[model samples]
Target chain A: MIEKQINQKAWFMVLPVFLLVAFSAIIPLMTVVNYSVQDTFGNNQFFWVGMDWFRELIHSERFHDAFLRQIMFSGIILSIEIPLGIVIALAMPKEGWGVPVCLISMALPLLIPWNVVGTIWQIFGRVDIGLLGHSLAALGIDYNYTQEPIAAWLTIIAMDVWHWTSLVVLLSYAGLCSIPDAYYQAAKIDGASRLSVFRYIQLPKMQRVLLIAVLLRFMDSFMIYTEPFVITGGGPGNSTTFMSIDLVKMAIGQFDLGPAAAMSLIYFLVILLLCWIFYTIMSNVGEESSNGGV
Target chain B: MTFNWMAWTTPTATFFIVIFCMLVGMTIWEIKCPGGAPRQSILHFETTRGDRLFVSLLGSAYIHIIWLALFASLSLWWAFAIACVYALCVFRWV
Candidate 1:
């Protein structure tokens, strides 16, 4: 066997990336970590409280409520978006003049800015002037997102689904497009049913992209802030205050720096742990499925 | 440039410095020994040196946070001990 080469020069090439990450990410992260442990008066004076902020955060009931709401919202989002996206993708035209039309119409929702989506939904759900709320009122429904907690929850969930389901659809469509003609030919020869084709041919082929879509959707939904903030402002009695919104309220609105910083770190860690679990479970399932439990 | 804007405190500075050292040390080890191939372990997935390190660091952070939450005091040594055990298990079996 030939001896493997080790080039020390590679470190020099990596230096620029290291510096970029250090300045962009590490420095800000370290600043937050620094603030998490220390309390402050005015004039940039800080006293080392040594985990006091962290202690307060973990034990706080507000934190628990936000966390549970976040988890529930993410669960609902994943459940709805994944299946709905797959179905939409399946029904999407694969060839002819309809393909671009379908693709562009589907992509239209995703191209809108997040804040604009929130604003649109906010207006569109107004009982007095907005289309959805006005229509619901005309139907004799007692739907008011501003005052009713259930209505507020439903509206935000609907808004998120409308805003983001396109992403899942696009990814799944791409996955579907990448499936070669031979797979369908093989399935046809075997006299496979539609569901069988989807199960053995489509889904297995789409697993990689679907995994990506699931992870992206899970993380984005878990960290949801802007749309809900713009629409509900965490109002109607804090029913929709996810962790990021709560963290912003603490850090910016209340100016509780230490607790806010601590909360941020904890919040990030929870997401990390959850994403890791999702990644592990999904990967294991995919591996087992593909390898026939080997 | 002064780091005064960072609101630097001694303990937090030391904490960051230690983490920096760990990263550098891991890189050096990878360069010298070069045993960084992905391997399957008890965790039922393939992991490399970097993956184990990431899990270890993340686990240690949660350990410390949990200790603070439960005891209402920073049990540095105990948390460290737990983190070491956790890291060892990850390194060996994950």
Candidate 2:
């Protein structure tokens, strides 16, 4: 039986992290909450404006557009990255020196800062000086991300895929590595084809890691700001303006503190809700699969 | 176009110095209470010595420089595209 005692010892171990996260996260959150309910007049003077900003943000067309765009962007990123990661993981060698090489390569993109990823793509897609843009122009395709909305969207999507697909690959690879050799041997003895083996063995084995990849990618993509903001600045007429970008514009650009604060709270809650849903679904699937195996 | 060597030097130097200090601090702390290496399971592979080293050096360098450059440039999208190619090459070959 598990110990029922009040484990004060574990709290000691966790205290440092708890304190750090509270300082970094909770304090700012409280500040945002305070700002959400109060109006500022530039010189430290404030007035109570309960629910006014919240209502304004909720009714704003700009907010609606950005919110929709954010959802779409997150959805596209998840769909593309998750499947691509699984495929890459499958193609990678199960064992040998190639394993380390592949793993390192896959992890390289995730290591780069979000802004760097944006900058690299921005230069790379330039028509005159940039390699990709120059090459495409040479091929007679007029690909200008700065001037064209479709091209800008494509470039942003491609950039995201390039930067984050590695994460999915690494996670999926880990899931693949954990599958026992005995499973493969059993399948082989039964004369299972490659497709069947992958279907019955690899797919099921990878479910948990895939779940993690999905949830993480979804959350990160939803909150993405730096890369796209740097790359497109929310233009070709707000084509690539995700919610985070709009929030930043509101908070810092316009100094609409109350509305920005409310929006941030709403944004945080949206992410929290999505994360909870993802967790519940994943755990349910895990339980069902385990039960089926048993 | 002329390269901004002066512009580059300060940040790069600062980054290295900070990293060096961090390593020194961590080493001292580890000696006091040697903890087991944390195990993180990935789907297709386990973490190896070479993998960890490569990631630590390359990852930190890329993250720092890219983040800095993003704020420095007038046109960030162009820089982002180039970085993607660089990342792709690093992953594919490095």
Best by DockQ: 1
What's model 1's lDDT at A11? 85
DockQ-based class of model 1: medium
Error at B85, model 2, angstroms? 55
lDDT, candidate 1, B1-94, per-residue tens: 8988788988888888898899999999888878786899786788898989999999999988878777765457898899999999998888
Model 1, position B13: C-alpha lDDT score: 82
> Highest TM-score: which candidate?
1
| Cα TM-score of candidate 1 | 0.95
Q: How many angstroms is residue A229 displaced in model 1 relative to the true structure, after the best TM-score fit?
A: 1.1
Which window of 10 residues has the lowest lDDT sum in candidate 2 chain A?
A: A43-52
Measured with C-alpha atoms, the lDDT of residue A282 in candidate 1 is: 84
Lowest lDDT sum, 10 consecutive residues, model 1 chain B, at B67-76
